[model samples]
Target chain A: MAGSNHTPIKPVHRARLDNIAVVLHRPHFPENIGAVARACKNMGIFHLIVVDPLDCDLTRILKMATHASEDVVANMEVYDDLAEALGPFNYIVGTTARRGSQRRTVMNPREVARELIPISQNNRIALLFGPENRGLANRELKLCHTLVTIPTSEFASLNLAQAVMIMLYEIFTASAEFPPDFVPRLASSFELEAMYDHLSRTLAKIHFINPENPEYWMMNIRRFFSRMQLRARDVKIIRGICRQIEWYCEERVERLLREAGVNRVDPEGDCEDRFFGGE
Target chain B: MAGSNHTPIKPVHRARLDNIAVVLHRPHFPENIGAVARACKNMGIFHLIVVDPLDCDLTRILKMATHASEDVVANMEVYDDLAEALGPFNYIVGTTARRGSQRRTVMNPREVARELIPISQNNRIALLFGPENRGLANRELKLCHTLVTIPTSEFASLNLAQAVMIMLYEIFTASAEFPPDFVPRLASSFELEAMYDHLSRTLAKIHFINPENPEYWMMNIRRFFSRMQLRARDVKIIRGICRQIEWYCEERVERLLREAGVNRVDPEGDCEDRFFGGE
Candidate 1:
C-alpha cells in the first residue's frame, strides 16, 4: 500500500516435510488425546505415537476427537518403553511451556519450527510429549541433544493438547508462509476472539469463582495469562482447561450425589460452588 | 554414578517386537527414521512406518543411530494419505514448531510422549512425520488428537531426527523417574536465548538506532542484547541479525544514509565498547 516499491519477497529455503513423529508419554486424560488428534489433522501432521499412557482406549478418546480426525485416532503406535518409542530418530528437542533449568534452549513456537524444518529434510524428527498433570522430567530432557521451552507465564500452564496445537500451528504456518518476511505471521482478529471466548469460559470453571462479585479473580487470572499475551495455541489450551473443569465438576457432583445415596435437589448451596472460598 | 543405589535406567517401553508398526510420511531424509529406530531399539520399540518418503534408505540414516536402533529403520510402513496411515491409532498427537490458530489443542513433547505408552498398549499406534523443508502443515497438525511442539530455539532450529531423539529420551527417562511430581516441565536456558534473539534482532533489523556514526556506532545495541542475558538461541539470533545487517545496510544504504546509515559499524561508540560506557 505504501507508495514505495519494496523488495520482492524472497522465497526462503524451506526443508521438505520428512519423517516426523510425535511421542506421548503417560498421558492421563482421553479427551486430551482426542483433541491432539484433531490438532494433528489440522496441521497435516498425522503421526501420533503414544508411549505407556495411563489409559489406552479408542472409546472416550474417539468421542473427544470428533470425526474428521478419526484416522489419527485409528492408527496410534503404543510402546511400553520410552526409548523403544523413540529409537527411530537421530536428533531430539525437548519442549517445556515454562522456564526451569538454565541448561536447555528455549524458543517460542515459531522459532523452533523455523530451526527444525531445515535439518529435518533428510532425517526422522520425533517430538516428545509428557502427561497431562506434569511435563518431562529433567533427566528426560537431559537425554536429548537440545532442550526447548515455550515462553509462557509462570502459572499459565497450557493444557497438553493446546500446547501441541500452538507449537505445530506456528511451525506449519511459518513454513507455509513461503516468501520470508512477506506474509504477516500475526493471527487475524477473529482467531483471537475465539480464544477469548474459550478463555473466559475456562476461568469460570476452574476455581470457586463467582461472577457476581468476581473482581480480583478474573483480573488475576487474566492478568496472569495476559502477561504472557496468550497466542492462538494458548487460547486452545485454555479452552481445553475449560473442558477439563467441565468434566471434573460433572464427575465430582455425580460422585458426591452417589455418596449421599440420593440425588437431592440442593439448589441454594449447590448452585454456588464455594470450593476455594471455604478453604 | 551412585553405584550402590543406582540401577541401569530402565526403558519406558521394552520392545515386544510385535503388533506394532512405525510409519514415515514423505520423509525427505533417512537418518531421522534411523535415529527413531535407534530410539526404538533402546527401549525395545520395534515397529517402523514411512509414508511417501522422497527417499527411503536405511544405511544413510543408520549411520548416526546407535547399534541396536537399526530395527526402526528395518521395519517401515509407507502410505500416501496420512489419515490412511494413521487410521488405526487410538490416540494421536501432532508435533508442531509454531503456535497455530486458536482452533486446535496442544501439548509439549514430554506430555505427548508421557501419554503415549499406555494408550498404545492394547491398540496399534502410529507416529507420523512430515517432509523436511516444512513440517506437517496446519491441516496435518489438526489431524492428530493434539498438537505437539518440541521446544527449540528461536534462531538455532533442530534437525528432524534430533526432535525425535529428544522426545524418545524423555519417554525413556520418564519411566524410571515415576515420582508423581518428579516431572520437570519448564523452559530451559535455550528458551531464554530465543526470546533474547527475538528482541535483539527485531531492534537491529528495524534500525532502531542513532545512525550518526556512519558505522554501527550506537551503544544501545550492546546494552540491549546484554540486558536480555541471551541463551544459545539468542546467540544464533544475534548471528541472524548480523547476517541481515549486511543485507539491510546494502539495500537501505542510500535511503538510510540520507536518514541514518551515514554512521559507522558500531551501534555503540568505541569508548563504550572498549571500556565502561554511558547510561
Candidate 2:
C-alpha cells in the first residue's frame, strides 16, 4: 500500500477522543472557564459544555485561554439545564468531594479513567463539573453513572480549573494518548543571554528600568525567563516584541524632545552608551 | 511495657516526618497558606516555611483552615530568601511545571514520592511551593536536588493548594501511613431524610424558603445535604440547630401577631399548612 517513493502515514487513535465531552455546570468565573478550555485543548478533548454558566462573555474567557485554544472556546455549547446538556452523552461521570447514600460507588480518578477509556470507544462520555462555591448538586449528579474524586485531604475543596486539569490528565494518561512533543529546538544559552541583554538595554533606553538600579530588575527578568522553558521561536517572538517597543520609544522620545523645542540627541547613541558604556 | 489496663499505643514513624518541611516561596494569599497548612497536617508533615510571604494574617488563614490545623498556622516560619528558608533541609525537592536546563531530572510526583520516602528516613527533606502568580524562580529551583512535575496538561498552571495536595497525597499514599479514616459512622439514609425534613420545616416557619416556590428550594437543600456524606453526629447537630430556629420563629411570630392586635393563629398549625400543606 506504499506510494511510489513514500510510506503511508499511520492514523492516530482519534476515535479514543472522539466521544469525550467536559461539562461545567454553573461555573462562576470566566478565567476558570477559559483555563478549562485550554486544558481540554491540551489533552485533545474538544467538545465543551457549560450548563447555566454565570457569565458567557467570550472576551473574558479568551483572556485566560490565550490565543492557542480559540477553537475549543468557539465551539463550546451552553445550556440552561444540566440534564439537557448531557442529553447527547451515553456515559456520564460526575466529579464530587462529598459522598452520600445515593452515590452508587466512588472511584478515584485513575480507576474511573481506566473504566471510561474502554467505554469511550463506543459511546460519548461526559465529565461533569459543578460550580466553585459548591460541587455538583445531587439533582445534577443523579444523572451520572459514576463519580470520581481526586483523592484529597480532609479539606477537599480544590479550585475549579485544578479539578478540571486533574481529571483530564488522568483520562488522557490512561488512554495512553499524548499530544505531539513540544521540543521545538530550544534556544541555546548563548542565544537566551543575547535576548536578555538586548531586552535589558531596550528597557533602559525606554526608561522602563531606572538607570540607578537596573541590575536588580535585569536579574529578576533573567530569572523569570530561565524558568519559562522557552524554545528558540519563543525567544525570537519575545525579542520581536521588545524591538517594536524600542522602536516606538525611539521615535516617541525624539518627537517629545522636538515638541519641547530641545536639541535632538541621538536616541540610538544614547541607548548604546547606557547599554555598553555603563556595563 | 504495658501500663495499667490499657495496652500501650505504639509510636508511628514520626522520624521520617521529623526532617520534612513544606516551604512556600512568596505566597500571596492567606487562604492558600491556610490550605497548605491543612494539607501538611493531613499528610502528617508539620514544618512549614514561607519565604517573603505577601500576607501574614493568622486570623484570615485560620478562617479558611476551619480551626483544625491551627498549630501549623501558628508555628509557620517565614524568611526573606529561598536558600535561607531551605537551609535546614538536606534533601530539597522543588515542585515546578516548567522544566529547565539545571533541573537535575524531571520526575512525576509518584516517582518523587517513592524516591523521597527512603531518603526521608535519614535526611531532612523540603518540598517547595511557589507563589500563585508565577512559580518558583530558576535560582530557587537550582538549589533543589530533584524536581517534581505533577503530571498536568500543556496549560499546567495549577492552584497553589491543589499542587500541594497532589504532591502530599503521593507521598502520604506511598508511605502507607494514613490519617484516621474520615468516615465516622455515616448517618443512615432514614436519619438523614428525617434531619432534612425537620430542617425544611424550620426554614419554612422562619420564612427563609419562599412560600411561592418552595419545591425548588427544598430540592436544592436536599441535593446539598446528600453530597455532605453526613455522619450520625453531624445529623444530630443539624437537627438541633433546626429545632432552635423553629422555636425562635414561633415565639417571634406570636409576639408580632399580638402587637398587630390580630388573633394569634396557631403557628405550628400554620407551619403544618405550609410545610406538609404546601408539599
Measured by DockQ, the strongest candidate is 2
DockQ metric for all predictions:
0.01, 0.04
Write candidate 2's Cα lDDT for B1-279 as tens digits: 455459765545323666788899999988778877877776677888888989978887886555678888888898998887787788999888786555367998878888877798889999998898889888888898988887654656766776786777667666454444344578998998788778666555444455566666677567445545666766775575455333433343344444444454433343212222222
TM-score of model 1 vs. true structure: 0.33
Please write out the lDDT profile of model 1 over residues A37-111, one tens digit for every residue.
766766667788888888877888886566777888888787898766766554455666546453334554555
Error of 2 at A35 (Å): 4.5
Write one digit per residue (lDDT tens) for candidate 2, span A1-279.
448359645533323666888999999989779878877876678899999989878888997666778989999999997767776666678899886544245777767777765566666778999998899876566556567776664657766766777677667767434432322344544455567778776556544454567665565345334324444565665565455444433443444444445454433443212222121
Question: Which parts of model 2 have CA positions greater than 4 angstroms off?
Answer: A1-18, A38-44, A55-72, A175-279, B1-20, B27-47, B54-75, B121-123, B131-134, B156-162, B175-279
Candidate with maximal TM-score:
2
Query: What is the C-alpha local distance difference test score of candidate 1?
Result: 0.52
